[model samples]
Target: MISIRSVGKTYRSRHGEVVDALDDVSLDVREKEFVSIVGPSGCGKSTLLKIIAGLVPASGGEVTIRGRPVREPFPDVGFVFQNAVLLPWRTVLDNVMFSIEMLGLPGNDYRARARDLIELAGLAGFERKYPWELSGGMQQRVALCRALVHDPSVLLMDEPFGALDAMTREEMGLELLRIWEERPKTIFFVTHSIPEAILLADRVVVMTPRPGRLARVLDIALDRPRAVEMEFDPRFKAYSEEIRALIFRPRRERVH
Candidate 1:
């Protein structure tokens, strides 16, 4: 579980002015729950993810994973970026084994696990292929396998499928659901697509622009073990629309 309380981040510009990225963002993510954060660009969605992952520090407030304060990147959490970030020289298997190596495990120990993950990700026949040799979707699959190879308890994904084409994005979404079924983990996904968030997450968190704050938390009560067919369901569309309204609702002026 991850808990963020009164978290705020501010940076000083070259001119000595402060820029606020996040403000008083508070939320709790339960174990085995898949949550996605959506907002306008520069809403600090990525910053919030990084803060939880310990990749960045909050200027104020607290972030904790499983009740312990998050000061540094924990081994139990895996991060996937928009780019695969795979090494050009590393083959698929070697890439997936990178985390195992980082954990100081013997090569022979994690070789089978890496192989199984690669195969499970639908890259069994491409284990020997380098990142450059595969399509964009295949490369993202490699990144996903690499993130999950170590069996992390939490997965932090920042638009992992945003770079793919429309068709490939849909395919990857279905594939991700299948993967989630096989191995349930606490997942925090950051994306701009309402449908994508509605389709994948148990809860969707909407945020405002800069100095990002939580606008709303929406529970997707569609169904469990969501399949691709769920996307066409009316409930899914209703959820999407509900979030859309929350995101763009008209504001009223305050009277003095």
Candidate 2:
């Protein structure tokens, strides 16, 4: 349902040096498929996600959802960032409804949906609470609800759980899977956690270091309705090892 064709990104450093963040990256994502991207720090995994969201422009190539080429902030796409980024003054319910207000969508139509998402995230009673009153996991849950309040067809998550504690992160991952199962949306997730990526994705995209290129797109063989305990399976370990090998090995030039 999504296609990233020969996408590349270059940035001019403040010191006037051109740095290539991504190079000739191409990938096709299926409908309702969860794809995770893993690579070293500064490998452009997050950059690629932003490019797909139309939040950042790609210096080369293109990203298209369904058949529409993304040129501006997409109306049907939802983005969750590394941080929850909730409004300090807005209550949980208000924060969840913030996207609707910003998008100029009718609040009457989405307020119920917002409340449903808040409830789904296990924060039903805290609708009147502020971000400062919640735990890190709770705050992130609020962000997730806000992102989905509009019923977006695609969700681009850039380390949405990265800031939470390990245990909370695991919980959030399982929660995300449940949400996806109930309401499937094509997701592009970027994370540094190899195990998290494996646990959450159908395919993991491994990239080379700086000037990131697709090193390998490993198809996860683990069964669905996955659980935290499944991370211990031998196949899961094998997939982790394979991705680790690709990331740490010498950077090979990938020409797509």
Candidate 3:
């Protein structure tokens, strides 16, 4: 489980102006729970994830995972960025094993796990292929495998599918759900797409613009193994409309 208490982040510009990225943000993600954060650009969604992952220090407040405060890069957390960020020179298998190498973990110990993850992502035969040979979606799948190779307890994903084509993005979403079902990890996914957030999360955490604050957290009551066709459900529409309204409404009128 994770807890973020009164967390805030500020940045100093080259001109010495102070910009607040996150303000008084507090949230909790239960064990093995999937939470999606959606907000406007510069709203600190990614910043919050970085804080949780301990990739960056919070300017104020604290983030703790399983009761321990996070102060530095968490060894038990995995990260997937907007880009695949694969080493082009490495083969698919090597890329997945890259994390193991960085962690100074024994390569032989994780080889089977890496191969299984590659297959789970539906890239079985392509393990020997290079990044340049794979499609955008396939490349991201490799990145996902790499993130999971170490079997981290929590996965911090920042728009892992944002760059793919629409069709591919949808496909990857389904793929991600399937993988999560088989190998569930506490996942905090940050995305800009409303529908994508709803489709993938058990709860959607809405955030405000710069000086980002938690606006609302809506529980998704949709059934499991949700398909794209389910987007037509009236409940889905209602959730989408509510979230859109929250994002577009003036801050003063917003209800948290």
Candidate 4:
């Protein structure tokens, strides 16, 4: 389980001005549950995910995973960023094994795991291909496999499919759902697409604009083993409209 309480982040800009990126955001995620955060650009969706991953520090409050406070990178979680960020020098198989090598784990023990993950990601034959040799979607699949090679209990994905084309993005989403169903990790996915979020997450977290705060957390009622066809469902459309309204709602006036 993951617990976030009153989390906030304030940073000083280059010009020496303070910027409030996130504020008063709190949430609880059950084991193996999938949650997605959505907000306007610059609302600190990425920041919040980083905080949960212990990649970034929170300015206030605390985030705890399974009763442990998060301060720095932990071993039980994996992060997939917007970019695949694969090394030009590494092949798909080698890239997937990179995590194991970096962690100083025995290569012999994890090579099988790496190959299994590569196969799971449908990159079996491309294991020897370099990042440039693969298309964008395949690269992201390699990145995802790399993140999961160590078998993390929690997965933090910051719009991993954001850079793909629409069709590729949906394909990747379906791939992610397949991976999650098979592995069942606690996942925190951050995305701009409401339909994608709804399709992938058990709960959708909506945020206010700047000085981001939790606007709402909607429990998606759509059935599990989700499909693109569900997007046409009335319930799916209703959830989309509700989240859209929350996101596009007028900002409350601030009285100085």
What TM-score would each prediction reach against the true structure? 0.95, 0.97, 0.98, 0.97
Candidate 2: segments with Cα more than 4 A from true spot: 252-256
* Cα deviation of 57, candidate 3, in Å: 0.9
The pairs that clash in candidate 4 are: none
**Tens digits of per-residue lDDT for model 2, 1-256:** 9999999999988999998999999999999999999999999998898899998999999999998999998879999999999999999999999999999999999888888899999998999999999999999999999989898999999999999899999999999999999999998899889999999999999998888999889999888899999988999999989988887776544443
Worst 10 residues of 1 by lDDT: 247-256
lDDT of 3 by residue, 1-256 (tens): 8999999999888999998999999988898899999999999999999999898899999999999999998879999999999998999999999999999999999999999999999999999999999999999999999999999989999999999998999999999899889888999999999999999899999999889998899999999998998899999999999999989998788655
Which model, 1 or 3, shows the larger lDDT? 3
Query: Candidate 1 has what TM-score?
Result: 0.95
Pairs with steric clashes in candidate 1:
none
The best-first sequence of candidates by TM-score reads: 3, 4, 2, 1
TM match of model 2 to true structure:
0.97
Q: Give the alpha-carbon lDDT of every model.
A: 0.89, 0.93, 0.94, 0.93
- Candidate 3: count the clashes: 0
lDDT for 141 (candidate 1): 95
Local accuracy of candidate 4 as per-residue lDDT tens digits, 1-256: 9999999999888999999999988899999999999999999999999999998999999999999999998988999999999999988999988988888889999999889888988888898899999999999999999999999999999999999999999989999999999999999999999999998899999998989998889999999899999999999999999999888877864221
The model with the greater TM-score, 1 or 4, is: 4
Q: In candidate 3, how many Å is residue 78 off?
A: 0.2
